[model samples]
Target: MSPTPSPESMLPLLVDYIVAWVLICTILFLGAQRLKAKIQFYAMQSLGLSVLLGAIGLAHQNTKALILAVVAAIGKCIIIPLILRYVKRRVPMNKGVESYVAIPTTMLMGGGMIMAAHYLTNHLFYNQSHLFNEMLSTGMALVFIGMLVMMVRKKAFTQILGLYVVDNGIFCLTMATVFEMPMIIEMGILFELLLGVLVMGILVQRIHDSFQAVTLDELEQLKG
Candidate 1:
């Protein structure tokens, strides 16, 4: 048996779900601490996002939004994995190991980012839309966290993951907080992410061939 949702209980939970969605995307984009873990996390996050979007669409009764939600699930969750598998077959990634910043430390910073986002969006940007602005703030924070992850981690593969997070953050900000963009816009984003992954897919081979070891840290010789 489940406890019923009071009006008060409902709103925060919804916001939390959106925040959780952002976190999932952030983790996906920020790169995983381990290779197998990152892949699994990405798949799980996409699935979670898909479910949330579907629920939001139904709850809000926005037919177009629901359709877009389904599209996100398919693209982010399934298609990306297939592409990743192909990439994996081609290159031996030197990333997916312990990071320079350390996972626990990065998490602490990420927590700080969420708090800062809330503080800014709540007090400074208070005049913004009452409904979705918080989500926007959360997205921004997640993007920033992803950026930090990229900066601190020297691995090229992880850097690409950071880029992925930034994309997801923007996508979430647009879809959840801003106006419901046309389906074409969402499709464009999916296409862009696909292209990025495809292009970077080749980089894996380049890294292995050039350095003989794929770690970006060793590539620092190029830093004249």
Candidate 2:
């Protein structure tokens, strides 16, 4: 009989699963219409990333990865979502946020970004394991998708969610490739994310109060 494969041996499969889910969440985020739905998708994506980090920690017996996973779960999945939900409740929801580009076009652009990421990863990580290259490419794709979301969406809330998506991509890359990222550096990144969210939330509230709209188009009129 063949010996059971160790958890370490299954790491690649686990990483692949999480990476796939993250990509799905990114797509859902792009397609979502309501601000609340976008926030939910971001939270789900963060939870998926935390799970990936936790799996890496368990496989490697790395306490830092485990702790970082906990922090990410609490900060990104729970606290951030709750805060965004509060802001959502306070903001007027009747206004529709039109995208700069159609959904189909945006999706096509996303696919092109993924292809570009794959090509870039191939050249940059030729010596790395196939799984590593795949994860890194997925991370890069997420970054591009996040930027697309920011560019296409008109709402300040959605734009903030896009920023979170970008941050998640960076986190995915760091955790997947350098599982040993210093705890202090991870904490600093988390702090910056939390701070940015809080500040943005305040700005969003002010914009809604002042302009009676939270759309970027409205804000742009203030540039004069």
| lDDT, candidates in the order shown | 0.65, 0.78
Model 2, global lDDT: 0.78
**Candidate 1 C-alpha lDDT tens digits along 9-55:** 67558757756775755554444567556656666765665666676
In terms of lDDT, model 1 sits at: 0.65
User: Which pairs in model 1 have colliding backbones?
Assistant: 29-165
Q: Candidate 1: misplaced stretches above 4 Å? A: 1-3, 6-12, 21-32, 128-131, 178-184, 187-224
Which candidate's TM-score is highest?
A: 2
Model 2 Cα RMSD, 1 decimal:
6.5
Clashing pairs in 2: none
- Report residue 8 deviation for candidate 2 (angstroms): 4.3
Cα displacement (angstroms), candidate 2, residue 178, comes to 3.1
Q: Estimate each model's TM-score.
A: 0.73, 0.82
